[model samples]
Target chain A: MEAIYIILAGSLVAVSCGLVGSYLILRKMAMVADAISHAVLPGIVIAFFISGSRDSLPMLLGAGALGIITTFLIEFFHKKGNLQTDASIGVTFTWLFALGVILISTFAGKVDLDQDCVLYGEIAYVPIDLWITDTGTIMGPRVLYISGSVLLVVIAFIFIGYKELFLTTFDPSYAAIIGINTTLWHYLLMGAVSLTTVASFESVGAILVVALLIAPPATAYLLTEDFKKMLIFTCIIGIIVSVLGYYLASYIDGSIAGAMSTVAGLIFLVVFLFSPTQGVVFRNRRSKLSMTLNEEPI
Target chain B: MEDFLYFFSFQDPNIRYVVVGSVLLAISAAIVGCFTFLKKRALIGDAVAHSVLPGVCLAFVVSGTKNPIYLIIGAFITGWLSLRFIDMIVRYSKLKEDTAIGLTLSVFFGLGILILTAIQHSGNANQSGLDQFLFGKAASLVGQDLIVFGSVSIILLLVVGLLFKELTLLAFDEQFGKAIGMPVKGLELVLTTLTVLAVVTGIQAVGVVLMAAMLITPAAAARFWTDKLTTMVFLAALFGAISGVSGAYISFVAPAMPTGPWIVLVISFIAMSSFFIAPRKGILYKQFQQRKYQKQILEENILKAFFHLGEADEQYYGHRKISDLISQRRFVMGRLKGGLQKLVRSGFLKQDREGWVLTEEGKNKGQRIVKLHRLWELYLTEYLRIAPDHVHDEAETIEHIITPEIEARLEKKLNYPSVDPHNETIPYR
Candidate 1:
């Protein structure tokens, strides 16, 4: 039963991250999501300090604010300092993440937060931190509810704004010309990324969260060119990889997050080598320029 | 203060190993980081730093002991492989470099965690301090660890020193290097290996995650201080050593603190300060230059404004009211007043109760300014085929910046034309 709950939580986190990650990959902002996952550390620490507990709402808001700041600082360095995008990202996240680690060790030493927890979160222990009610009623895993609701909100958001998101993501100018609020939608997507990242941080930690966010969407991208089909493929692949990863972890009794990421990577590797159209072997036979013909101009 | 004395004094032989290991690691990381920064592969350091974890775990799993040599070898293998994987993904797939790097880094790190967790569950007694690889425990830099770090640092530094010229050529212009038959690819491989070696050696000191900063930040900070490659490398090494030793010292003083974050924090502080304070490239320097340029442009425009006023009359050098200059040129009242006062102090203008007038000396200076403007305007219209109307705005900006050499060139190029395309007199001194 605990395994089932853990798997369900993993699946939910994967789906939410994968769905949001597809858009991130399309926008060429996958690493920005990576930055948010790490930069939110101080936010979570501050939220934990202020609330004196890991209440989901305050933590969400804190991580969300930091996520926005991360984007702003990346843009700030890229535009103002004239650093390359990758260099700006490298500087901002490492600085923020280092600060976060220092804060946790300094102030939150009393709390359960430790280097182990931050590096590799124990998803297997999620079932232990149950959401119990008064009079001995077992509600569910706290992460399940948090991540499940996030998954629902993400689904609803993507559903309601499908056309707008599709247009803005593929071509923002076209979306704006067609009267869509592209900037608003851009922030909306970033908001969803922040929320999903925070919700998954406890289950998989920062590094694995990045893996889950980039790997599945990247794998699905190799399988198809249709955006809608790509989204569906991502969620399906995310769920499959999460379930497989859980079993692999159980078999080896290792980290679920680690196992899940490894599984996602394995899936990517197979597709990278053997996908029908975009596989490495197939593309190797063709000219290098031919492979890039379908790609959007950088 | 006592703790500082003890740490710096190195009374304990163990402290010597820790401090020495950290300093060597810092020097090596900084030296190799120069090439990485120049190559625009700074983030690859982060990726390889994370990816080396699996190799460490695999080494521990294979060797069943905490041998630093085995771990280094393991790390090198995986680190090297991750770089290949990233390059392959970028070359073969439609995914961009950032995505490939993110994917490769996290996935390799995830594999490392899985192996690490499996090892932990296996209940090895030596598994203690293995978790230190995450955030690093510098206190564990014992005898054997120092040997590994010291030897690797020496080798990497030696290689960098030997290949400096080749590496610089590869970094600055790869195609040029290849065109000159300099074996660019081989040089790049050597640099990448050195980067991996630096990362592997530094991992025990700063851990996997923060190691990238050590690899990149010192070089970034040094870049602000100099444009010369050799000077930048030396400064970067100096900065890296300071941060490293200080980080280890602080971690020793505060038992709860990890060394990696402290090192990162210190280096980031250096980098941030350099960004704001370095002489030529710093933000403050640029801001000062911009302000000086703005003042120069404003003063020049005021001279032009006075010359324009003098143009309206044949004999009068024109004492114009501040309001009239403000109305004519759209100058702000306070700013225009400041420009007039500055010009008066410089003897370019004379201020009276009625208004301001160009001094006799100022008239010649104004004539020179008006001459450059009209010369550029004429050059644009007559030589470059620009319309008479379009040349005004171009010449307005160009008039302030035209060097005497460029002004001379324009006059020669335009054949010493006496009047602009607008048929206005081209004043010449």
Candidate 2:
């Protein structure tokens, strides 16, 4: 029963991250997403201090706001200060993450969070932190509910804004000509990424959230060309990573989130080596075979 | 107060070791970071930093000791591998550089965490301080650790100094370097090794996570202050050393405070301030330059309005009401009031009870502007062959910017034309 809850929670977080990660990779904002994941640490800490709780609306709101600020700062430095994109991201996220770590150390006694927990997370505790009703009824794990709702919200957001997101991702000028608010959608997409990152942070930690957010979508991208099909494959891969990672963690007696990300990496490596159309090995072989056939005909 | 004095006094061997180690680590990282920042691979430092974790854990698992040499060797191997992997992925696959970097960074970190946690569960006694690599242990720097840091710092500095010219060329233009018969590929390999070494050594002070800041923030901050490569490198080293000392001091005073984050925070503060307040390229300075130009354009446009009113009635020095200036051309009322006052103060316009009159100096100034406008309009239509209707807007903008030399050249080039494309008289001094 504990294993099921943990796997289900991992799946929900994975699927949500995979959904958002698809757009992030397509838009070439994967590193920006990585920046937000680390940068939101200060926000989470500040929110935790103010609200004095682990899981609350204020925590998500705080982290979401910081995520948007991170995006704005990166863009601002790039466009206004003339800093390169990579440096701007590096400077901004490290500063914020450092601030978060300092805040944690300052309030180490009061805050239940630790630096190690912030890095890899405590997904094994998902079954332990149950949500009990005021009427004395026991509910399922709180992370499951949080992650499930986030997945649903992500799906609805993508579904409702599919046309705008698709057009903007593929062709921004055409989207602007058709009067779609590209900037608004850009911020909105960043906001969704921030929210998903905050929700998944508890189950996967800050850095591993990046793995779930990037690896599965990247893997799916290699397997297919269609965006919708890619998203579906991402979710399927997410589920597989969660289940395999959970067992791997239990077998090794290590961090479940860590195992999940490792599995995610392994899956991507396999797909990278074997994908029929895009795999590096196969593409080279196909070119060689074509050259041979042409020579034979000559 | 006494603790501050004592910490800075460097009387204790522990404080001396921490201070020297941090400053050395920071200086080396900052110097190498300038090259990486120039190459526009700033975030690659971050990927290498995270990727070193697995190598670190594997080294500890195999060596069963906390030897600094072994740990750095392990970290270097994986850090270098992560860069290779990112390059390979981008070269072979359709994935962009960013996606490749992100995938490599997280997966390697995840693997590192798995191994690290497994080692912890295995109950190895030597694994006590191993987690310090994640956040760093600057305050706990002993004399033995200083030997390693000092040696690494010397190696990094020596290589940077010896290959400064080649590295600069590699950073600014790799293709040009290759065109010049330079071994650009070998140079790139050397720089990559230096970057990995810098991160591996610097991580002991600022930790793996904030090590990127040590490499990137100083270089980025120094870039804002200068355009010269030599000056920027020196400034980056200075900024890095300053932050390193401050980080050590901070942990010294506040025993519970971690040193790595504080170092990153101080450097970030410096970088942020540099971005805003540095001269020439700074945001604030650019805003000031823009405002000054806008004000100049505004004052010139107002003066041109008076010149137009004078041209209409053949009264070059006639007094005109403020209302009359508005009737000729629209101006923001508040800004127009300020512009008119400024014109009067500069002796361009004389204010009287009835209205405002152009002074002798103001007339020449205004006449020069009108001539430039008409000359540009004629030049555009006659030389460039633009339509008469399209020449007005072009002249309107060019009239404000045409220097006296350009004005004289335009007059000579247009053969001293007295009439513009629109048949307006071209006033000349």
After superposition of all CA atoms, the RMSD between model 1 and the true structure is: 3.7
Candidate 1 lDDT (Cα, 0 to 1): 0.88
Q: In model 2, which regions exceed 4 Å deviation?
A: none
Candidate 1 local lDDT, residue A174: 89
CA lDDT of each prediction against the hidden true structure: 0.88, 0.92
Q: How well is each residue in B1-429 modelled by candidate 2, as lDDT tens digits?
A: 999899988999899888998899999999999999999999999999999999999999899988888888999999999999999999999999999999999999999999999999989888987888888778876777789877988999999999999999999999999999999989999999999999998877788877889999999999999999999999999999999999888868877776889999999999999999999989999999999999988988888888899889989788898789999988999999999999999999999888899998888888888889889888888888999999888888988999878877888888999888888888877
lDDT of 1 by residue, B15-73 (tens): 88888889899999988988889889889999999999999999999999889999999
lDDT of 2 by residue, A183-281 (tens): 999988999999899999888999999999999999999999999999999999999999999999999888899999999999999999999999988
Model 1: per-residue Cα lDDT at residue A297:
81
Q: What is the docking quality class of candidate 2?
A: high
Best by DockQ: 2
All-Cα superposition RMSD per candidate = 3.7, 1.2
